[model samples]
Target chain A: MAYSPAVQELMEALRCLPGVGPKSAQRMTFSLLQHDRSAAGRLARALQTAADSVGECRLCRNLTEADLCPLCASGRRDPGLLCVVENPSDVQALEDATDYGGLYFVLKGRLSPLDGIGPGELGLESLEARLAAGEVGEIILAVSPTVEGEATAQYIAGMAADAGVDIARIAHGVPLGGDLDYVDAGTLSHAFAGRARYR
Target chain B: MAYSPAVQELMEALRCLPGVGPKSAQRMTFSLLQHDRSAAGRLARALQTAADSVGECRLCRNLTEADLCPLCASGRRDPGLLCVVENPSDVQALEDATDYGGLYFVLKGRLSPLDGIGPGELGLESLEARLAAGEVGEIILAVSPTVEGEATAQYIAGMAADAGVDIARIAHGVPLGGDLDYVDAGTLSHAFAGRARYR
Candidate 1:
């Protein structure tokens, strides 16, 4: 038998989540209905609020409720050092792990020609405008190490060159605490080529 | 740095779901904000609608927008055969796998003394009322194989005996397609003890 219209709607809506499938959506729907009505209400209000209010920061393209994201607006960050990444989550990851006092520019996606994502789709003209303002002296490419990420980094590096800003890609190597024997051959060779000299 | 108030609230609300922790909540919040604003809005409206409208069925205590659940209200089901299950999901599972044209009564929980769950909390009084109406001739206990489930099954069996109705517990044995070696000793012993005569 089919679920009630409201339950079916809730289950269908839950399928919009990143990893949730039909079975998980069904389970989540029943779970919310059976228990935690107050929490369910709060979740509803939160979803509405976030959906209606959250938008991209005009300067960095990171998610924010204001014209400029907190990172871009903060005076403590170094305006001359700009880090470019693929998504807003990447900004959070960098903030959590590093003490870098620099601003960030979120691309919101990588260059995927098959999916129709390109330079213009990523709002690169706005990024070019920011770089042309002459405040950012160094542009750090902190995108992923995938092939698309590499191509996107290269394209951004060319843009940085045109803007006369020093560009650097984040280092990729065997992760810390990862065994050299377990590392892939391509990564091992890359790490060897970029090896540092002993102090 | 802290997330914006809207994002933070969404994350906190997502944490209310079962099995969702802080990290998953954060990821879900960002995913909804970045990839699917329309879906997020739909989920919000669904949550509010479901929470506001859905209520327990008056006859069987299963979730329903109407006074009676579909199973109870349907004329095709056998009113003489009643299946007692611990949760509404169990009813769905039975309907999916078995062609038992019987109606169902959802307990919403089992007998867990440590958690203060008892007969009253499980709405056994309503179950007894249904039994007393004399339409039900056989009762099938479909609770889980946990200790609490066992106690609940036995309690229901005693009630059925007092009401002069036939009662049967669903069989517990090795699951279909499971390797014998992989089956636990308790299940193995139960299967051995309940062996049937060859036809």
Candidate 2:
């Protein structure tokens, strides 16, 4: 009663995606069998095409099919104001906000000392080189406010300080619509430290 | 700033998978830039291979990589008892149970007149032809107990009756662990109709 080897292998391969588990894998495998064979074909093709063709932009470290990512290649963007993020996904999220018009530097990972992931592993040497180019006037640290994220930001801040670049971290405090009572202790403390002066 | 044409096209293509939206497509596309390029390549190859190689089994109509599916070709199974199901995945589920040693016939669909699906669309004639071959003895109707499923079973039953083959529909009653109090009206009525003789 075991499934054919091919089907089982396909299910296993599909389980690699984030949030996909055994049950979801089974459901997806079954769906591929039931309908939309073309979509399944698309998934397979996308996986291979992205792998083969897509690479990081040498300037911005964002994903691109060419040597430079679109954000970096576009002459319209402000290269002088670079935002540093832990992952490329963060770049997309920031884009959805529609507030920034600057270049980006993706770490592709965070500084996890316990997991043996250090600054060198996250392409810090390239950041130093970018800083030394003297074209960047300001750097906005857009890493998340989590412990690992904070550590990485502090590390980058120290590096930027030595490079004589103006360093600014993204705000970490109360959310716009969040109730004061519901705010967590760490966030409340940050809110207090980052309180804006009233006229 | 607008994404480069390559980045934008690949992102849109990645969104074709089930549950993958524009946001996820972007994230996945971005991650592909960081993780092994070969994984994406493998996914694309798997898609094409599955699409091009996998097709319906000639005998049972279940999905297969060969002319005859693994189940049909296996020498260990009983060819005389065929379990008729509505989809290839159902065959997989039944196989997973590892109890039934019989053959299978996948209908690919049920009789849904509302949705323009009918017996002719599900290869009822091919099923009759298989029965006329006189190799099958007991034909088990393993369809779900929904209205459409019941109607399909009835239609197949009439055909089997004309062919002089012994037809048996799987019994429908209260689910094994279901509570009588919470059972729906339709299920309650079906349970009454399919009741067994009390000792």
Candidate 3:
């Protein structure tokens, strides 16, 4: 059906969001027009303001309006311990789920040479410079277990070894409260091989 | 975790969208800021323009930026075959799913006196005036079949009877291609009661 130019343009622009297709964009357009004009205006202003001002934190590559992110700026977090993750969302996930009181180093993406994402794109040189400055006592690798993630983690581990800093990885295993029958064979085998002695 | 003021505000504002929660809001915000700044600007402009300009169609109460929506303004559709529906979205759904080439009168909502919705809210007076003008040959009730919907249909049918216009309700039953075992008993009973003769 042909909508008015304004409505049609709104629907088309809404599709730029991930997972939003034509149907969903139509629904969103009608919902905003019918229910909340104030909310629509607010969202528009917010999008414009954030797109203009938000940038990567200078220290960790996490998204922030200031030079450093709130987590990086906070004096409460330990500077001696650092956690490496692939995306800003991953940093948020780890912060919410874990009690680790260390700083984070966001890689932005894993090492994918075929995709043209190399050490430069991931800001690895900045990370190496920070490592060589000799303040960090331990480094934690929290990247995913995919092939690219493994390569990225090993490269960071090598840097840590050269800097004479301790390095450890987050565990890979069956999740707590997960049914063993539903676990995949590869994960099960990996868990079995890395089994620890009972308490 | 505390995000920078701009980032946090963007995430919060994104939750105004239907079905978007905190995690989804965060993802949308980051995606717009990081990957598609141009899309974010376009979306913001579109939202502001639509919200500032769009209003209901004078004849059908469907959303439009002009005096009438594209369908209502078109001379091709049969004005004598007006289909009554609950929302602009329903009009869209019918247009996509059926070959119905007719004008529409959008009720916008069903009758629900308990929640303070009545004929005045649904623009039924305008609908009645059109019926009295003696142009529409049939009134098709495409409202849902819930208790409120049934009450709404009955009220409109009463108006049709007084105006000497033919009235019919859309069929309710087990959906096409649906398994009989999976059909709810209420739908089955309704379908059985409304069965038609076969050739």
Best by TM-score: 1
Docking class for candidate 2: medium
Q: Looking at model 2 chain B, which ten-residue stretch has the lowest summed lDDT? A: B31-40
Q: Which candidate do you rate higher for lDDT, 2 or 3?
A: 3
Query: What is the DockQ score, from 0 to 1, of model 2?
Result: 0.50
TM-scores of all models? 0.95, 0.92, 0.94
RMSD of model 3 against the true structure: 1.9
Cα lDDT tens digits, model 3, A53-156, are: 88899999999989999999998999999999998888888888999999999998999999999999999999999999998899999999999999999999
Candidates 1 onward: DockQ, in order:
0.71, 0.50, 0.71
Where model 3 places Cα greater than 4 Å from the true spot, the runs are: none
Candidate 2 per-residue lDDT, tens place, A123-196, comes to 89899999999999899999988889989998999889989999998888999999999999999998999999
CAPRI-style quality class for the chain A–B interface of candidate 3: medium
What TM-score against the true chain A does chain A of each candidate get? 0.94, 0.93, 0.97
Tell me which residue pairs clash in candidate 2.
Answer: A44-B44, A44-B47, A47-B40, A48-B41, A48-B44
Q: Write the per-residue lDDT of candidate 3 for residues B1-199, one digit (tens) a residue.
A: 6588888888998888888898789888878988999999999999999999999899999999999999999889999888889988899889888888988988878999998999999999999999999999999889999998899899999999999999988889989999999999999999999999998
Candidate 1 lDDT for residue A45: 98
